[model samples]
Target: MEQIQEAYDALAIEFAASNPKSKAAYDIATKCLPGGNTRTVLFYEPFPLYTERAEGCHLWDVDGHKYVDLLGEYTAGLYGHSNPVILKAIQEALKRGLSFGSHHADEARLAQLIRDRFSGIELVRFTNSGTEATLMALAAAKIFTDRSKIMVFEGGYHGGGFLFKSGPHPVNVPHQFLMAQYNDTASVDELIAANGEDIAAIIVEPMIGSGGCIPGTPGFLAHLREKATEIGAVLIFDEVMTSRLYSGGGVQSELGITPDLTTLGKYIGGGMSFGAFGGKADIMSTYDPRATSTARKGASVPHAGTFNNNVLTMAAGSAGLENVFSPDVARTLHGRGDDLRNKLNSIAKGTILKVTGCGSIMNIRFIATPPEDIHNVRDLEGQSTLLLDMLHLYMLGQGFYMARRGFIALSLELTATELDGFLEAAQGFLRKYATLVSG
Candidate 1:
């Protein structure tokens, strides 16, 4: 552990020295933006690199250092930095207008594209972000079921306000939350047995995104579906990140377990800020303003957002989905991601380094004697994050950009050669830190 700390300190010093411009930028930013960041996930010790420009799968930082970008803007940049189709669509939309303050044709077109992709989503309502989508989904569920309690996993993260890392955060919306364990049907069953009557919704991430990229076991997810039905609770699948794993429907289609509501965001907006939530017609119909009985209690749920159907997001999302990131493209990316993860595991065969995730998104962790299948974040307890921090700096020095927390999200513009380059850099890091990474 002392040796590892020594190595991490050395790497940190090197990082600080190399990215002086970014350090200066951070120093200046701290005067305005709290903690020198608007997004919490992007910050790291010393400072985070400020990208001046990006093209394809590469980023040039303020210090003029070039790197292969694997962060993918935390899965929102799936089409890469500059997709010609998306850019053209945005340009065309700009000519028409920015904010129409009314409905447009592209909004419905984009919604239709989403509905076609996910069978579970019958009616779609857009929001500015994934956070808003999840909040609205919870609201819709509570209204539809006429219950107040929401069931969530211990490590699950829906949005900023819906977080449940250890427990419901103080900043979280005051929904009566019931905590359960991810990938553990027994824990869910126990919770349902206690509060089934008051539970309005069961929200889960098919693949836990920020909570260590852990995937919910097939049986566990199926059990939730069964339990939700038995107790009359609305099942909401938060597929904000997992939707990119499959080409046709999503993780739901992949596992053949459909939920009552599915919240979506990230790449679906073609790199523009966007979100959507939809599900069973009966439940989603609660938001239908056309209903005649407005006077009746709970007849309709009013949902309004200023930029829900903004022209830029609708246009870019439609063009990217239709032309760039088609079903064939999605499938290809999934295969490549699997192959990459397999090779990564192969390279780190005897080391403490292990990777976990579904397709196109993965995370690195230094776990001694890691389990064959990581079902949840609890399975990764006591692992040293210091090793990941060291590796992050080492990879950055090797001209590769990834999240400081060891996250890597692939983009459509990233080529096989770029991936190969990343693998080689990873191999170099392992060899360089053989003493520290050895099991």
Candidate 2:
């Protein structure tokens, strides 16, 4: 039976009725926060499930409905909730203090760890969030190159203030962004030819996390590196979401193509708000606070943040990198993610439903037929949000939590059984909606 809108509403209505406490809380929240929501992604029709608590890959809602947490806090909960190591680190940091409001020794330790892991990152600076990291990276690029234009690909999302989906986000810092097609060397070449002289930097997420978990082609990424170096434009890889792909290293390591600068965040902070940016020493040294001779010569980039090295985040992040997401652990998580992505694609092979991603992150996409190459943003257009929402709600009813856009990520804590369960749930969704999703 093809489930109609009424059927979908019935499920949502049932979900709302069963969670009266959450609905009531939402009703109260509306008086304070807009639409009773703070994060736009968490809101859905009817209402979002109010999670009371979570441990490992499971969550309990306010109504006490237990769900397998496949969402993984949209990739921030890389260790899953309540990991003993991260929890202990947080608690211990709290006991010591929250913020010193000055430079701390632990910050250097965390920096050393990051430097040792990321081959492309020789120097780094912490930020309160990924948004800041990308923002500062761009600032440094423009200052170094003395250019006013930036080259960004469509569907590439660097941060909250650096969004370039349909168009530049209203809240985004205004920049002359030359939009290029992702994973398309020809389109990138066209943009470079048009704006190369004035382009200071090219910012890209190796995998478009928010737009879709779309991975970049190695050829395309390498081409960007070559062209950017030729034009003196800094190439910045925003690996905020993909940083956990291989512990501290990400696509740069996998593809064997390095960017001049890299921005990182998400799971790197052990589920805390964290972000970092770094690259070659010459570029990063521009932000040196030390009294350099260049200071008297009037060439310095002053970057400052009050909570850049909050003790809690520094301690938790260090512990997460050293203990939780070790190379061995990261490899296991990536393998499981590859397994789930393959299973989902195998199940939806002949249908409009297709899964696309790499490593431990992916997204479900609905189109008439899988494109011969999803190498550009234009290739991924015309996606049906209605189908995605229906599946999202259906999965939620089946005790799975996920993004409305069908994004799913795996944490180190997930087991083979849980991975199998997620695959089973996807298969079930396809079976129940087979008549509808079938071409």
Name the top lDDT candidate: 1
Give candidate 1 regions above 4 Å deviation: 293-299
Report the poorest 10 consecutive residues by lDDT, candidate 2: 290-299
Clashing pairs in 2: none
**Consecutive 10-residue window with the lowest summed lDDT within model 1:** 290-299
Candidate 1: residue pairs that collide: none
Candidate 1 vs. true structure, TM-score:
0.98
Cα lDDT, model 2, residue 121: 91
lDDT of 2: 0.84
List where candidate 2 sits over 4 angstroms from the true fold.
Answer: 1-4, 293-296
Query: For all the candidates, what are their Cα RMSDs to the real structure?
Result: 1.4, 1.8
Model 2 TM-score, 2 decimals = 0.96
